[model samples]
Target: MLKTWQRCTSCCLGNKHKGDFMHIYAIGDLHLSGEPPTKPMEIFGEHWRGHKEKIRQHWLETVKADDTVIICGDISWAMSLEEAAQDLDWLAQLPGRKLLLRGNHDYWWTSLAKMQKRFGEHFEFLQNGCIMVDNIAVCGTRGWLLPSAEAFSAEDEKIYRREAIRLELSLQAAAKQKPAAIIAAFHYPPLFARTEHTAFTNLLHNYGVQHCLYGHLHGENHISAFEGLREGIRYKLVSCDTQGFQLYKII
Candidate 1:
């Protein structure tokens, strides 16, 4: 475990799941280690601060200690582990066993095994990992954006393919649970900006993954105004930094 400004979290084992009919809360990109910036809303004239209290209140009330929460990535913007600990303490105060994924800005994150050794008693820090939660299979990857075929450079294709492979591998591991449902999580949208049928999305479709959650875009950069929900399946946007960490209830 490491120390930061406010609290502490030992990186724990991930891909360990159990039960059925879980009240899963999906949120990511909180960047929650410091006092939040309120001026962004004032300068940009956006609704940035609109949902902060709402999300926190709703989560504390909705989540029992047994429930599971997925912090999809970018939990902190702290530059080092010591700086991050204070922030993690804030996360620690929240209820539920957590499944933490990586985000591009997570500078303090080390290897998954190290995380497990550190926080094994508490939260789960996952990377290309899977778990079972109450009869549901959960797998996750911090996917990278691939260049589209229209703009596909060979290097971009190679990197995208690698990340895609990692995603599939994680899903395959999670499939071992033979769950009643499957929810895949990522830091970046498996699909591209405003285009739903990207390669990663198609791969997930082929696997028949029933639900998906991701984040990485803000209001200014948002390409899809609509959340990814359709036909009894869920395509959720879980960027907590922007959404004030609103909990996504999977009933």
Candidate 2:
């Protein structure tokens, strides 16, 4: 076990010698619409007006080709791969290496193989997977609400367990990469509320993951979103609107 961990540590340290140090950024819930059927986000609230432009400007000003960005999901408003390509086209022009996870509203997200074939390498999709940059490993899944949630049902519980398993798969993948640190991203907040503990949080503890980034909640729902340190892990809500449409610097 120690030898395996050491190998990972060495791999992480070795990655830093590639010229310049890497900068990592994370944000979520982009909710971008595509093509002629563009869906206006302003309907959700005043904050979403021109959200795409806001994200573009912020990304241009903040990230570089050498930097890494994690989009925690709800990326596009498209209903199929064909439409999603337009959004992907715009995202490809942006600077930095990007890892995009899925959100509830991401109907266009299809098979990873199909997406890779279509977008090439413009971005990586995180579904029961992970990515590493220098010493930081990013792992994520579309988390689900716990059984304790007010609206939790038998069906919700079933999906919740599946999501938890996916989260574990992602974390395990990151662990094998042997990163010095782990940052977990989720489309849904891990916990139903700040004070509530769940299987997702337990997994973070088991894996020694130090930070968690998430989105999905918006407007008044932000009040229940978890933030700050809990059980040795730091949680951050990176919803674009919540973070003022700016990328949250993770390192």
Candidate 3:
């Protein structure tokens, strides 16, 4: 059955409630493949074996129908929408409303309209807009690598600036709602390693975002990703592998 909030179709902006949510959870980098798995994640490490089941079990144990889960990105291993059916179906069966953002590896993600039409009833996609979950505003974009990164190219600079503009658009939408708090999600770490801030991080500060969730780093790369409080906003790395395949409660 659809929850009261799910009944509204105005892109999460129309839904309003009197109280706070039961909880808000987040995790990312699902990288799921259909059964008879073509892109096995175990190659990353033995701990990745049976990762799908691990995520399912943890999700079932932690979330309720009333809660929300922000899936930061890298949601599937499929190259196209048709190929992603099985993985999408698997996520659809889980409990709670899911908010998805784009990841660097999400080639299956086409236009927002197509994705929403396919799974909007159970999932909310955050592109160049924001969603109001009760009094808190959920905003995000697929951020790009910082200019400070090694081998940064002119093309990377273009994409980086474009993503920063997209994030600002989402933040502007959220500000109009006058939400009690703002939470930003990203597929890439907004800030580079050993760096204090970037365009993405500065935007969060400008918007008074209380929390920021991100993913993408894995294995040894995880060591360089920054987390914890920075200039008031609490940033967290929620990659599925980093979190032991468990949902990290944000509320």
Could you list the CA RMSD of all candidates, in the order they appear? 9.2, 3.1, 6.4
Per-residue lDDT of model 1, residues 1-251, tens digit only:
11111111111112233223336778877755465632233243354454445557878888988789988887777777667776676677888988888888888888777767766677876667687775666788888765643676878777778878888887677656555567788888776444456656765665667788887777666555346564334687877645654687754
Lowest lDDT block of 10, candidate 3: 1-10
**Of the candidates shown, which would achieve the greatest lDDT relative to the real structure?**
3
lDDT of 2 by residue, 1-251 (tens): 11222234334545665535567889999888874437898888888888888989999998989889999999998899897888889989999999989999999999999988988678888888888776678899998877777799999999999999998898888878777888899999988566787989888888888889999989889987779988778899999999889999987
For candidate 2, the per-residue lDDT at 97 reads 95
- Residue 141 displacement (Å), model 2: 0.7
lDDT of each: 0.68, 0.84, 0.86
Score candidate 2 by lDDT. Answer: 0.84
> For candidate 3, lDDT tens digit of each residue in 1-251?
11112222222333353343367899999999889778999999999999999999999998999889999999998999878889988899999988999999889999888988888887899999999887778999999988879888999999999999999999989888877678899999998554567999888887888889999999889888788887777889999999999999987
Q: Of 1 and 3, which scores higher on lDDT?
A: 3
Each model's TM-score? Answer: 0.78, 0.91, 0.91
Clashes within 3 Å, all models in order = 19, 0, 0
Candidate 3 regions off by >4 Å?
1-21
The total number of steric clashes, by the backbone 3 Å criterion, in model 1 comes to 19
**What would the C-alpha RMSD of candidate 3 be, to one decimal place?**
6.4
